[model samples]
Target: MFEPVIAPSGTLLGLLQRGRGDGTLHALAAPRAAALTALNQCVLHDPRHDWQVENRSLYYARLFLDLGGGLEDIEAHLFGPGDDPDADETRTGLALSVLGHLASYGRDDALALLRGYAATGANWAWALDELALRDDDAGLRSLAGAVLGRFPATREGDAALAAAVRDAFEPRPWRLWAEDRRVSVGGRVRAARESGSFDRWQRQMRPTGPRPDWSVQSVFDWAQRGADGGSALHVPAARCLGAVAGPDDRPLIVETARSGPDGARCAALHYLAEAGDPAVLDLVETAVADSSRTVADAAVAAFERMCGEAAVDRARGWVHRPDALGASAAGVLACRGGGQDEELVLGALRETVRADGPDAPLLWALADGAGRLGIGCAAPVLRHIYRETSSSQLRGRTARALAATDPSFATGFAVECLWDCEETTREVAALHAETRDARVAERLRRLAADPAEEAEVQTAVRSRIVPQSPPF
Candidate 1:
């Protein structure tokens, strides 16, 4: 592996071995503020980069934490308010692996420190995710709500923390619809109908200024004040029991949904449902009472998105409305509220999942459904897109839907995509296949002999198909 750029200092290691965490931490060997600054190094993508193969991504993560600068702080500096997203994405990917570990087994303060970063870190891509995975729902929602009310006072939501929220909120609309459908009993049919996008869901987005990564960001605020049952149904029950803050609370979602924008109410309902708290039923009913048809439709969508096996009978009440059947089917699929309502979801979709249809948004919903339902039955239709679809974009998306549902097929197609180097197919093909696969060698070697290969193709071929591991 290439030598570590920020290797743990020798004396530093010796000191830690002698048992020094708090002392060294407070001493500011790497200032918490300094560590919070971003780190993105530029390398020639040459033999030096090969170092990662030897130790895997070990170059960027653990030792960095051991050095005590803290990954969260580093993420903030790199992606925070004044940072560059594309320029810093590579470094953040390395940092992300580091942050994941910190969340799971780092010091109590280490987790808190990361949480603080999640709160305040620049929107460098993974900031929000790190927040979510670490269970900071309030922070996540706060960030979401704030962003919607007003973008950070910068061009393109420049604040790193804000950017992070936007990244998650940005809809791969088709992907979402398709995923929704993929995981549903209705499969592609639902996607072929009324699924929506970030535009539709935007009414629900609100983002605030970033907070300390160490701050608890609100993942499960429901089981609080010393409540601890650990039941399988705890989160669901908490939500149903009205875990959502009422109108008196800051940014009252129910009120926002009722009187806010077009789909605001749906987003509110959706967020509540995902809270994994069944206690939210009163809130849902209250929302329905206060809602416009648009909002009511959205609230129903929330039920599909969040409520699962725990709230079956109540969820069934939603499917009875054929006009709102799409959202209801999605709700049931999301949490399996009424067991596997595959027929119900599919019944909703049968009218929509047509080829060459205008329902692109719904296609993403379909994909999401298929993924949730875990149905291998839809593979044929997906495989059909792979073989016969004329629109490359749709074809690729369909393939994505398939892969999301069955990762094995995604991996398989990715290898073949590498060889599809015709002008029309090159980037899409390259996108699916990574450069480091074992078979890449043979593929590149084959390309190396092609006199008709484009210059770009030949460069790619020769750069990778090493007869031997080209020494640094």
Candidate 2:
């Protein structure tokens, strides 16, 4: 995936790109033309740090509804000149998802667009899946010819059709087509279904990876093979070691962790750390000092996995150091340290933001730790991260941390958070956002009635609303 170009956090585009709640508030307050332009930019070129994980479709769709926006930009983006539907789904998946949400909200234009795309789009499977969730049987039945026509009657075509049936995310449309007498697809669909089931069975029957009888050396060899192939297998190989190694194998395991080949050393370190070997801490410290980044990263990861008091004690001693191990020790304290370690966690939170800015990967764990520890003083830092970070997932976590520590959350971020991209963030808003504001109450009512909202978010909304108000 290409690295997304995130605008400055102060701009409306940046706020929207980050999926911050304030983006919706600002967009609504801005001139309609500018807002629509920014909104179109976001929907047309997804700004999510990881589109597969971060949520923006529903948020953008809701904005469209509020703005009374048209689907012209979306249509142009989906079916524009030079656009390749057969290309990576990432290119068009976000737009399709936005359209799907819009359809759920009873947008006839959105539904029509989806029906058109599924029949001819290269990413027809994705569009079909969207229709499966929202379209009627008639709407789905109309697409069988176009969808099935993708495969010819040749043997290779049949094989491709079977694979499509087997890998489909939604079988509703396919099943309906297979059962409908009016549609001529019944015979072919039934054959494809049977072939797909057989393909699944054949794949499951094929055995791969380490068996229960694997020896420690065998596990090491497997890890080495994965390393040579550029895949990391040390974590699983370490688990395999746990199953196979005996009391007599301690010395060899220790030696492997100390001076073996890279793959074996990493695996041995993970195994020893998980086993809580008394000498594992020193070995981890030594491995951290190693020159190879892979070995050092593995060593730090192994150290962080440790949950014993011994690990905590070592963390306190190492937390002040400036190396990666020190950063990891701070994280350990943030995750597993006691009340006394609160200051260290806060300091680490600040230092990380100051040193690497809010988008640092380490902030995710540290942000959770801040909330878990109830560090009230960390509120300012948490708020900064919530606003400036381009990652929606991280912003959601930071919002949680803020709710736990910031007293103004109920009146501040919580109100805007009701419109945040991530459902979990919105859920937090529903639970804590003060209902004193008319906007909060209206949003609560709307969310409670919206069929597209998550069940958890709806439940949270209902909890905040009066029970006597039937059907929201």
| Error of model 1, residue 175, in angstroms | 38
Residue 43 CA error for candidate 1 (Å)?
31
Off by over 4 Å in 2: 182-184, 209-213, 467-472
**Which candidate's TM-score is highest?**
2
Tens digit of per-residue lDDT, candidate 2, span 67-180: 999999889888876368546687788999999999999999999999999998878899999999999999999999999999998899999999999899999999988996
Find the candidate with the highest lDDT and give its number.
2
* Predicted candidate 1 versus true structure: per-residue lDDT over 327-416, tens digit per residue: 554445534533266555544434344633423444445544554565566665555444433233344455555655555663565555
Candidate 2, residue 80: the lDDT equals: 76
Candidate 2 residue 323 Cα shift, in angstroms, is 2.9
**Which pairs, if any, clash in model 2?**
none
